[model samples]
Target: MDISTALLTFLHILIPIYWLGGDLGAFYGSTFMTDPKRSVAERMMALKILNNIDMAPRTALILAFPTGLALAWAKGWVQIPGEWVALAAVACLAWLGLAWKVHLDHGGGGGAKRLDIWIRYAMLVGLAVAGIAGLKGAIAVPLFIGIKLCILAACIALGLLVRRALVPLFGAIRTMATTGPTPETDATIIQVNEGARVLVLMIWALVLAASFLGIATPV
Candidate 1:
């Protein structure tokens, strides 16, 4: 491979590393955040740490698409226009900025978060379509690549589902922080986390499946 291609390949490999590693860290943090024995202040501190660690996977997710696309182009797997590839990279960077804003802004970055959600929704639709079409031979792409796209779509969908499931958990945590934990809030936190844990596991599986596709490229 050429140097640029080699570099892109290296970067693509790093994405799943950060994605999975960061997710494990955040998952670990959630335990501390939800532990009833911990002080409220300590739990809140855990939540902060979780949010910060989550940025790694968030960043890896944003970069994955463009990096994969660039690698495909470099390998002659596809013939996308340079301008379009550049545009995709730029858009991913903007999405990365918005993602950080949503995380870092204590105000919640409501509008930005909404925009980010819509973008993910759009991506989910697009990836699903492309993957299905490619698999059906309607699009000119290899089977493993098409499967990778579908895997990516599933991961994104599960991510949104996790976010949705955790909304009530966040609200409960906030209520606990201000008003102190009650049985009801504690129940909500545990219940929500339990549900989200399943979704997170599914995401982990999909990420592994994507990695396998990239490496094996089965016919």
Candidate 2:
């Protein structure tokens, strides 16, 4: 790969790691969700993780589009049906917008619930298509594409599950906008921290898929 392509590929891989690892750390950090935790310090640690979890997704969202577009441009792979292309673009835009909301709205309810859910569903589609497209010239089309696609799907699903899991806690925060975060709310955030494992999985999947595609030189 040329230097530019190499850097883009590296960024693609890095974004997911930063995104998933950060998100996963935040998710798994919450050990007190189902339980009323015995220690205040532990809850505090989990809350800290939750506070930063948004950063991962936000960064990933920024890179996903341009990298995906660049890959297609570099390979002249824009042969996707016009309709599919339009759909892909729309999905990309929507995903970006939703991810932005996740950060702009942060932990509040200013419209993140719906956006978060839709982002996962849309990304699930986009990742599926892009991953398959990566198989066009691969050395191991069946095994590589299928496995990577599966991993991406699982990552998207995990993202969705985490979003769903966070709804109640986020709602609580919204409800308590005036009252401020309580011990219970803090615990809930910590609970979400346990989902960090999913983010880590996402990061790994991105690395494997991108490197495989580059090596496969799929077009």
Candidate 3:
């Protein structure tokens, strides 16, 4: 392939990485940092990294569709249907929730942890449907189906894991404001949360491997 073609390929995949990778890292990494054994300084560093993880993926997720749609059309994937295009629009709305939370957190208002959780699941549904349906077509595309399954599985795992961590955020009105971390409450839950996130990354690694094996395009 020519340099420009290769560049297009890179851009195609890179956008999803930014969107999926960044958010997953941030959400799951925070749970890992909650261990009492870690010094406060370490916790602070983890928090900083978690913020990057949670937020950086937005850069790619936000741009990928508009750009990907153009690329898909150029590659003659199919003509755009209004309903599928509506899914893309809902994806943007889901992303806007994250952006709202980010803006609030940055501006010194309390963060929308609950809202983030809501949007997380919402986006998961959006992405999962898009990826799966993109592959499960009237005519089969084996490689595309494989790639979509990997991504969808990773997303489903991520949603499950983050949902595990979300309980504390949901209960903030009652307990989280003053309660200390117990062995049962904080540390162990985080371990499970992190483990779930690790699963997401593992699946994602598989997705990338498949992509390299020409999974994104049909034979």
Candidate 4:
């Protein structure tokens, strides 16, 4: 219960709570945005709210990696070298800064967006490799840790999938704003939002599973 361990433990618990809570807020806002009964202005407002609230979950997701690793080290569940753990924290912080820059740029593409995309792709591959290696005993780690890593990889993948699915919805929203809400545009928005919702649910499930594994460490 030293200071570093206490702080890591607090973060380990706090991140998921905010991740799930923020996601729920964003989900609700998205539902409002998709409501045909709502006026365009109202829906637009909801979309804005959703975007702002979503930062919480996105930030949590980025920070989870280093915090989880630090927690594992603190609890003696893993023997990651101290320097490696510190490097992971630094990398996570750098990623977080890149993520915020991308958010502020909002896909305007001064290179932050591209960098963020590549970073996510790199993370996806790295997590997959680490998960497989840990599970196969190439890395000396607990089964629970390996499974948690795999689950986290899945969560990241699902987040990307959700983003892809929502692209069409954004386009449709623009069209609706310009051309007025036609049936086709509304239908497209609804369909894409539904697909994104499914992927989001999967991500939430994986995150909860990872959290449970962290707490229980069930082999």
Candidate 5:
């Protein structure tokens, strides 16, 4: 492989490592955070740590698209304009910056969070459309690549669902923090986690599927 292709391939391989690894950490943190047996302070600490650990997977996910696009271009799998690729890089960087802003400021309900979510919606829609078109032979995309795109889109959708499910859990956490843990708050936390767990598992499956597609190309 050419040096550029090799580098892109390396990045392509490395991202999933952080993405999956960080997710595992976040998963553990979530379980610890929701345990009713744990002290309130301990649960709060776990929640804080979970948020920080989640950033790794978030960063990996944001960069995954641009890296895959650039790799495709470099490998001659698709003809992408240099300007378009550069634009993608810039946009992803901006997205990453916005995400970090939300993280550092600890502002969960603001314009920044809304903007980030909107950007993810755009990415999800774009990937979904591209994957469908590629699979239908309406676009000049390779079969395995098309499948991988769809897998990525599924992952993003699952992530969004997980986020939505967690909103209630956070609300419960706030209630618990203010008034101390109650059966209601604990139940809510458990319920939300149960729902989110399913979505998270789906995301894990999609990530694994995408990795397999990239590695084996078994379309």
Candidate 6:
């Protein structure tokens, strides 16, 4: 393979590997956080670990767009314009920056958080539109590629759902930190975790499917 193809191929392999690996670590940390036998401090540590590990998958998700597009272009699987590919790379970088900022400022003021949420919504819409266009022959790509895009969009949606589920979990953590852990607080943590786990698992499955489609290119 040439340099461009080699680089894109490397990224294509790396992204999903890190994404799934990080997600598994996060999942394990979350399970520890919900373990009733663990002390509050231990659970809190697990939560911190979970949050930090989650950044890997979040970064991968943002980067996937540009990387996948570039790969498709390089492999002659798609004929996207160079300008569009450049625009996508810039946008992906910006999105990755915003995602990290939001993570760093988890419970801070409004601006960054609001912008990040809007960005995610915009990405969701963009991916869905791209998939629909490809499927409709507006974009010249294989059916499997379009389906993979749709699955990726679904994974993003599932991520947002998991975030929504974790809202209460965050609140419960704060409550525990402020007033010590209680049975009620523990129960709330466990409940939120269970709900989030379902969504997260769905995301994992979608991501794996997308990866398979990208590799197999099965129509």
Q: lDDT (CA) for every model shown?
A: 0.88, 0.57, 0.56, 0.87, 0.88, 0.87
RMSD of each: 1.1, 6.0, 5.6, 1.3, 1.3, 1.2
TM-score of each: 0.96, 0.57, 0.58, 0.95, 0.95, 0.96
lDDT of 3 by residue, 106-159 (tens): 524335665554655665666566567655663433445435544644554554
Tens-place lDDT per residue, model 2, 1-219, is 788767766766676667656656654555543244434445445555666675676556445555655544444444444465456567666667666666566446756756666656866786677566655643234344444554565566666665566666665544334455567766555555445545555656665565565458532
Model 6 residue pairs with clashes: none
Candidate 6 structure quality by residue, lDDT tens digits, 85-122: 88989988987888788889864758988888888888
Off by over 4 Å in 2: 24-49, 76-94, 109-112, 129-150, 167-219
Select the stronger candidate by TM-score from 3 and 6.
6
lDDT (C-alpha) at residue 138 in model 1: 90
Instruction: Assess candidate 3 and give its TM-score to the true structure.
Output: 0.58
**Deviation (Å) of 182 in candidate 5:** 0.9
Clashes per prediction? Answer: 0, 15, 4, 0, 0, 0
Model 5 per-residue lDDT tens digits across residues 1-219? 978889999998988999999999998998987899999999999989998999998899999999999998887777778889889989999999999998898866599999999998999999999999999999998899888888888888888888887888878889989889999999998899888878877888888888888888654
> Per-residue alpha-carbon lDDT of model 4 for 14-39, expressed as tens digits?
98999999999998898888888999
